[model samples]
Target: MDMIAHNDSLQLYASDLYHYPSLKQPLAGLKSTKINLLFGHDEPNKKGVEDWTFSSDHRIFHEKKIPYIYFGVEDHKDYHKSTDTFQNINKSFYIDAVRLIIEAIKAYDSYLPIDSKD
Candidate 1:
């Protein structure tokens, strides 16, 4: 979709783009899930490495050495079929997830800008 291009446009000026929610299914009431990032040594429990590795636009940013984050979740059984609908979303989880992401971003920002993290 146009979202990828929109993100690409931010590559130059934005400090970083933390990718999230390219969800195949809406994240709703699910409570057991967590946001994942590129796994790094010594942070095994906090970071997760590689999903959408071969298939997502995030790979383009990775190749370009842009500051970005890949926060992904486990795919549900509906993965990518037409059956993925708003009706199937876990509404409460979606709200909570958004809040979690916002808070995490705030925490990350408090330390340093993304481009300077490396």
Candidate 2:
């Protein structure tokens, strides 16, 4: 988290190999963007496989209370396999997922350097 802030990042949104078709869950930090609402809400499933708490990088942010979000999709047949090639990706879903992240960044940029009272 500090490293991201040191590098001048407004917020961090980590996108894995796949993203959900309609839901982009915010795994940690401030839920201050419309993307947070569009993707439902900031829900951290500490014990779940997709849980950001389990990710070493994300865990640092979570522990430090820094802003972060995680985007991912349910496991597919090709997950973690040789068959998981670029050509097998869901292009449309991936595109939308990227767009959503862009939108989130744009929205947050306008109100960045967030001042937290915590």
Candidate 3:
């Protein structure tokens, strides 16, 4: 109960501080789901995007041609070692990353068919 309350409080604070629009679907709904395989762009220097090392059920996904879009930055010197703060974030680069993902999703959804084999 205390954890739930804390999470709710944090969610409320995030919404208030950032004007975060409430998502209709819960996070639980996204787990184990195949997201659309939208186009991805990495910077020329390969700053934000890199090969994901975590093991995934990709072979199964690929056998069925499941699509997914991965976004976010690579682990660098500033990653989670007390140096990765809001101030260190690149604003323009972040914006471009977001825009590219948004466009990719739009284009992918428009062109691709929903996977009927579950």
Candidate maximizing TM-score: 1
lDDT of 1 by residue, 1-118 (tens): 1111111111211112323322211223223244322221212233573234434666687677654654444455544656556555555545544655565556555644367556
The digit string of per-residue lDDT tens for model 3 on 4-72 reads: 111111121101101112221122122221232222232233466433322233334434644343343
lDDT of 3 at 48: 62
Mark the 10 consecutive residues where model 2 has the least summed lDDT.
Answer: 1-10
lDDT of each: 0.39, 0.43, 0.34
Better of 2 and 3 by TM-score: 2
Clashing pairs in 1: 28-90, 28-91, 28-93, 28-94, 29-90, 29-93, 39-48
Judging by lDDT against the true structure, name the best candidate.
2
Model 3 stretches with alpha carbons more than 4 Å out: 1-66, 114-118
Give the TM-score of each candidate: 0.51, 0.50, 0.42
Give candidate 2's whole-model lDDT: 0.43
Q: Candidate 2: how many backbone clashes?
A: 0
**lDDT for each residue of candidate 2 in 1-118, tens digit (9 for 90 to 100):** 1211111112234543122322232323334442222232233532444443444555565567554555444446666677676666655445545565566566556545666875
- Give the CA lDDT, 0 to 100, for residue 41 in model 1: 21
